[model samples]
Target: MTTTAEHVDSGKAARKRVPRSGHARWLPPVDRPDPVAVLERQGRDRLPELLPIRYGRMTASPFAFLRGAAAVMAADLAGQPHTGLTVQLCGDAHLLNFGVYASPERSLLFDLNDFDETFRGPFEWDVKRLAASVAVAARENGHPAHRAHRAVRETVAGYRTAIRRLARLGELTVWYERVDAAGLLPLVRPARQPRHLGSSLTRARRRTSLQALGKLTEVVDGRRRIIHDPPLLEPAGAGDAASLRKIFSDYRSTLPEERRLLLDRYRFADAARKVVGVGSVGTRCFLVLLTGRGAGDPLFLQIKEARKAILEDHLPSGPYLHPGHRVVAGQRLLQAAGDIFLGWMTGPQGRAFYGRQLRDVKGVADVAGMNPNRLLAYGRLCGTALARAHARSGDRIAIAAYLGTADTFDRAVADFALCYADQTDADHAALGAAVVAGVVPAAPGV
Candidate 1:
């Protein structure tokens, strides 16, 4: 197993996989699963009423559909020819999936924020998702086909260059490199809209804990509790208090000594059922409010239900034993730094869940308002971020060597993007047709 020649040839052997241009292929099996049935199956464990909301959002546009249809894409991608190179993938690596979040150091870092579907899989799976999402996003912003293609190329270029560069760095340097708000300027400056970057960063800085406390909670019964904005946000019901305590304790045990001590200082105040995001609309997500030393010192943690990653069924078996631990562990490996309180626990009812600060100056940069130049610039940043994430957990020499220096990989991705986007549009149309036929029961508008 440790033959010197084989060991030395590993990186070179990986490069001999499907040609860089082979990424241009996009095909679906004749008997592909109906997206409606897949969505319905995914909804089996979710709230029955909230499932419609998921449908409503997904039916909004092809881009929205892509965000919520990670399950469908996983199946399609499984059928593609991916080199055996694996990384901890953000199962749902859409354009919106990458954003600015606070690291443990309290500094804003731009990185992948959602890991609901994160798992060990081919690196191409994540890149394909990102490229396709960019294409759909360009359409949402009314960009032309040429501009959409250009955006995909930009993303691949950033990713290729970053992976290549990181392969040559010392291991520690690769591990420590990160992108933050202040560091975001240079990434997008070539696009020439520095004004928008300043405004976006300013808005993110304003979303502090105190600001969120004012917006999401109000005092009641001489104590502060999270506000109930019904349907979307409602008070947690009875019969779960015992399990909640166990969940909290178990989660605390998963943290390091310092973080556990920090968490121990806070007392749980209240929890409410809150629906969030496109794909996660129906999961049993709760916004848990905790008060620290003083009444005004508050912490809001989200306890989101963690089931099997949607990609797991399609991808090869992974290193994760528990899906909850899978999410937490994969996130730590990919992000430059993680939330101090990030942890996982299994509930008394045997449900798996992960806990984290609900927000950390974390805001999605709205792609709808941005012009083509800004979108392309943002595309590059997302690409570079993805490459860095891959390098952190993957064999950088193998991946980078496979990618090489040519733009062949770049153009292949652009081709793949356009093809998958068309497929997503068709799938979106099918969902819309179901809504019109009244079988899916989606809301009138998102």
Candidate 2:
């Protein structure tokens, strides 16, 4: 909560500390950490059997590599000069990380969905990561270099515009602002697309607990239980009634009294390991099923292990020793609307874990094969969302002023994104080379 800038002319002060022209600048001669070694260290805590899948997914493309290399980027970001303005960072603020999910009112809302790597860091760090992602994704889709740069510029412009607009409003107004599909459907909906948002929304809506149960579970003797698929959706050994009761109680204790009462209405039924995102493939992720009254009513909660965030060791440690609590706290602070089951608990072996709805209109957007113009539009949406998140958690007035009204910062960011994207490609290639040389184990085409 300390200001690194003078009270007056704060914008000028920030520019002086980290010149706008130097935003694209990176590193100062000394060699960087071995990215392969970093990956090896990260693998130590993950499920051993799933590490091959993680490597295979990461080896898919440069963009996938970036998603899995949060640790490497954190090391780099830590070495850079910062404005000392901190926010509750999503930590991995890539473009694909944002999505549409159902809010408390059942309204579809767009915001940052992944929070496993959430932590406190420089606000611009998140912005830079987002810009890099836009560039990387555009390149993956075979867009021209100029088009990628243009998209990055548009993203920065969107962030600037959103921050300036929010700065003019009251704190409460900024806090309440959200991106809703219903509000945007009329403007963004395309022709001949029968449903709003065309296919994406429809896919998300169909990802209900009942639908998941139908696909992933069946009658096991007298009771219905989850079907197991080795390495992806397997049982986490046999469950102990007392241990399960204790963990459930601990998770419930993290929620508000009202939320706890609401959860109490349902009885626990079954649970299974649920392999999720590319970066999180090796993590211990599981889905719990709860039933209420008739068999028709089913609720699924995803319980995911929370390790020390990628930013934890790089930045000064805070009061949160429990990573699950850190993730829950960061998610609540950044996202306007959060899950009703957003809570944390310490699991067996003292592993931190957080639980949320397995899927409630939870949809992830894909940027691959999108045209330059559409990619630019997607970039704008993500940038605006990032700015809103930072404004909620950081000194909004100072940040808005620092960015100013000129296009200088936007151009600088675009340049930085292009340059760092080149760096990411090199790093990604090194990872692939390492795998080929047997320095890193990998299973390709998974």
TM-score of each: 0.96, 0.94
Candidate 2 lDDT tens digits, 1-446 = 44434422665678789877678776533778888888889989898888888888888899999988888888888888887767889999998899888898998888899899998888888999899899999888899999999999999998989987887778799999898865654434444443434467778778888887788778788787878887678765575334455799999999999999999999988878878878887888888888887567888899999998988888889668899999999999999899999999988888889999987888766578567766787788889888988889877777777888888888888998888888889888998998899887787766
Which candidate wins on TM-score?
1
Q: Which stretches in model 2 have alpha-carbon errors above 4 Å?
A: 1-8, 27-29, 185-197, 239-242
TM-score for candidate 2: 0.94
What TM-score does candidate 1 get on C-alpha atoms? 0.96
Q: Candidate 1, after superposition: displacement of residue 109 in Å?
A: 1.0
- Cα RMSD to native, each candidate? 1.9, 2.5
Q: Model 1, range 1-446, lDDT digits (tens) per residue?
A: 44434433555576567778889988778999999899999999888989888999999989999999999999888877778888888888898999887777778888998998999888888998999999999988899999999999999898999998998887899999998778787767554355777677778877766777899998998988788897888888765655676678889888999989899899888888899999999888888888897878888888989999988788778877877899999999999999888999888568899999886787778877777888899998999999999999888777877788889899999999999999999999999999999889887454
Best by lDDT: 1
Residue pairs clashing in model 2 are none
